[model samples]
Target: MRLASTIRGVTYSFRSIKEVLAKANSHKSGDVLAGVAARDAVERVAARAVLADVTLEELRNNPVLPYETDEITRLVEDDLHEPSYAAIKHLTVGQFREWLLETSTTGELMRSISRGLTPEMAAATCKLMSNMDLMTVGAKAQVVVRANNTLGLPGRMSSRIQPNHPTDDVQGILISAREGLSYGCGDAVIGVNPATDTAESTRDILMALDEVTRKNRIPTQNCVLSHVTVQMAALDLGAPMGLMFQSLSGTQTGNEAFGISVSLMDEAWAKMKEMTPTKGPNVMYFETGQGSELSSDAHHGADQVTLEARCYGFARRYDPFLVNTVVGFIGPEYLEDGAQITRAALEDHFMGKLLGIPMGCDACFTYHARMGQDELECLKVLLGSAGVAFLMSLPVGDDIMLNYQSTSFHDIPSVRGLLGKRPTPEFDAWLSEMGIWDGGKPGPRFGDQTVIR
Candidate 1:
């Protein structure tokens, strides 16, 4: 479809070219036609560039860029926030999940995100962070590929591909390549999730990323390195829970995961101490997800009025790489019809901000096979700004494409500009200073872990 659109554009450009040439025979008409031709020619080139997969930065940064931002700027407006738009467009699942977690404590976040209501529209222009975060690599990947592609790259894979096979490494390789590409593209601060169970695993993931850079020839500048929650569960180590700590410590994976989750988190300084070796401006992400049942119980310790302050407090103190949280509804319509009404009531009537709301792309509903037409994918995009996190969802691409898009490429962040060089040691020092290592809290630390009876 994208190709078809480009081809159609090229055909139109040619038609304009002919008209311009014919008009060139006359002096006055020729000048206007010539200008039109010049514009058309540039548009033709840009259309082709899109076919080749251009980045937002490329399109925006080009001095001679043909298409003006205004051409598509209309798509950037509030109507894009409409539920109808999101129901039919691209939806970013993971980023949406992240946003919910980030804003869970910010009472300012929106709620009743089911459908018919656009989170972005509900918020004002002061709410720019949502779009900013959406511009990140993760968000771009989601919007560009949709949910269909397996590898998170341009093309799709066959069912015959095996996991251990080279074909199966698509997601990891794409992640590594995108990280390197992002660095080359001026994204210096990289967010990484190392789901390693051991020291060797962490080393392996990092080594793999380094290999991607080396192989792809990406320049290495000082960048921040933040460690996500290490694999700390009994399942992670193939051990049972409540076992003596020493009994499981002998295993490499067991020790590494344990170290990060328990000791590193227990002591902010110790956490920072271990991160020092990475030479980074490090941030730790402690993510937690309560099952559908226990999730309701989350945030009980914090009052509605203090949610924002508390969440921000944790974010400021820990300065995490990213916070991963989750909020799921009983049905997809939870966001659209009635949900929107409830949200309006909370905001308009109560003047309340519901944290951990989902931002959704319009297409999420139709593409999600699990739900019928009445339900839309209840996803939200959250941005960290104004000392309060904002949750907003806009319709971009569709469900058929969500998976595919996610695996196809890195999502672009909302912030535009080249990545600034930050010493990795800085990140490390920050983590250490936060007492994330020795005194860091361990998991099941993040999200709601309590199971329902």
Candidate 2:
């Protein structure tokens, strides 16, 4: 589909230009054409410089640039221009461990160092460290930041559930949601990727979810992941703006194709702020993954992780309620194996926390990526310790529509038990009232099993 167009004589497509343009204009009745036209003009100019020499074929074939070790070294050295530089230079690894354990400001120091290195370098350095050391750093890196919303989304150091369904089937969506909630999940938000990607379909799903939430008395946000234009149409049609969803990337060209810019995002944020249910936290939900810039033909020779951090910086401007990095979802082309995925997930959480953004990790992989459940489990535990804000809720760890395996309903209690954490405050109360959770522990039910006489 033609995902982006510019008046500067450039066009970009996810499939074909006709298909994308058709989808873009499908909500003309809602007056989305004007917004699309304005976005096209801004994106055309923003993308012109990046596409000057690179071909779309090159971008597709070479999604990630080769890492520059020398450049990374220079950047790391430059970043040590702070008070912590002396301690880092003089302390032995053991002494560093002791110091990390002894000091309250280690998180501040680690955040500074993390901001200094590119994600590639951070991953490489972490691979050589022991898991204990990694965990120690990650645990200390947790800062008490909140998204400031009513649903109490991510009010603790625990993970939230994101049970996503294929957009076409309302019944199937509710079924998945019920399955997740039965396991005491969906504290993050019960969201779906709409099949039709139209305003009517999006509105229908949102309204359905709202009704479900009210009936069940689940203290969570409801969302249908459609294009922003389609979502605006749904809002115009009186759909509750419970959760405003968007996928963003680092580069200007990428944001353009996604039909987002600083101005556009600000506009959306204002609209949601004015209309969202007063009883919930902030209404914005954003999904970002590394490699999106390259996928959109917008990489400017920066490392994927670096670009991913830039995307977080952009999202922070809006003070979004939830920001999730689909850490390994892009595939092996960007991150080669389980170890790479693990490090990338840690780096994303660490970086996002340092940036003061409420962050979550979709610790998952595609089948072709040669990753497995064991790798996902490893990353999940590490992120759980790192105090990630939330996780994806796939029934039994498998997403039928997205074709990936992520954290499952069963994984929630497993991680919380390991960390002595519970779901967000409001959801925890709801779970307790439902007799699904007792005193911050999973109720008598476990996994896919039910009791019998």
Candidate 3:
């Protein structure tokens, strides 16, 4: 018999394994809401205390600990008042939506809310909003915040040249970097995932990348994406901390599996501060994806997207230089097709930005997921509209090591050109000097030179 069900007088069938996975993955949105409810329940009494103006000061003072109800209640009733609560006291959801839309800067809005409401409280109230209202808030937040603040990203359109090497082949890495830079990408950074995961391998790759970058006078930082411990060892071996790298997850357990801990991150940050960069801070690069919690068995029944946001919260603790959500990389088990992939990518970008994280989207998918380049392209343009900080640069839209299709080096100039954007200022100058960028338009070489010469 067919595995089928009837709903609202319509019957649906899971025709293939992919369809089954799609149906299973479609429950993630509901799971997210359920997870939120479960999490909010634990803080329900605290949330109410804040709403009742019962314990605002105590909560603010002891931000490090879990809330104690009786003490907080007594403190709240002791005549302490929060101005942020007062600001939103008489406003309805519709009114708040209008206010948020009209607000010129997120910093001001965030500051006002910080006086009283915790992010959980704000998110709880947001749950009452309709999807359209939530979408409006996300869109408005990005516009106002981006227009008014740089967040943590560089102040121009940037691209990351991800010359990921499976075998850490020096020639392959150099060729890939050369190709991406020739097409006016790599303004933000040129990073690689070494074929082997070890301190020596990572150091060797970083050294090789450094040699090529200096030899060609390319204006970009370099990274070797191995385990954090390996990279830390590389730093101990005298690799510059200009481009520290890590992949973070929402839960503590998830991080432990990757041999990452908050203390380790702190050590890396401290190490970064010890190094000097020619431009910008020695920023760290972080990659996170939805379904990671589930894949790692750390999901805790929450929506994957919600868990993904928690990952951002964790990453933000470090003030990361770059936070990229590889939106569709998890495959059909979590996000089945192009439509789900596109929606998830937008949601991640919107949520990340709303949470005040400088976000980027690796709009990519795997062949096993039954998705294609066209869908990724759609997500890329949508993210560009949302003012994503940067995107991955593969050679000709294909990553041989990762075995995935993403926006290629050529796609960068085309997307930026269409949106009236340019690479980060320093990289733009380098591109101009190299004759790949002419004024605001791309030079002829940009279109003609797809392969490394």
Report the number of the highest-TM-score candidate.
3
List ranges where model 3 is wrong by over 4 Å. Answer: 1-99, 103-155, 276-279, 444-453
Of the two candidates 1 and 3, the one with more favorable TM-score, higher being better, is 3
Give me the displacement of residue 285 in model 3, in angstroms: 1.3
Model 1 CA lDDT for position 418: 17
Q: Which digits, one per residue and each the tens of the lDDT, describe model 1 over residues 199-254?
A: 34434444444454345333222111223232232223321111011111111222
TM-score of each: 0.31, 0.70, 0.74
Q: Which is better, 1 or 2, measured by lDDT?
A: 2
Q: For candidate 2, lDDT tens digit of each residue in 1-453?
A: 123434547554323321222232211111121122214434433332222222222222222333242222232334323453433443322343445456576666665543332332232223223455555555666443333223223225444445555557887777777777778777778778776888888888888888878877777777888887788888888887577889987667778778877667778788777777735345687888867776676655444555676566566666667888998888776665787677677767755665546778889988877678887897888888777777777688888778887888888777877877778787788777777788757665533222200
What is candidate 1's CA lDDT for residue 182?
A: 26
lDDT of 2: 0.61
TM-score of model 3 (CA atoms):
0.74
- List model 3 lDDT by residue over 328-445, tens digit each: 7777777777877776776666556555556777889888876776767777777676667778888887888988888898888878877777776656776777678887987766
**lDDT scores for all predictions?**
0.24, 0.61, 0.61
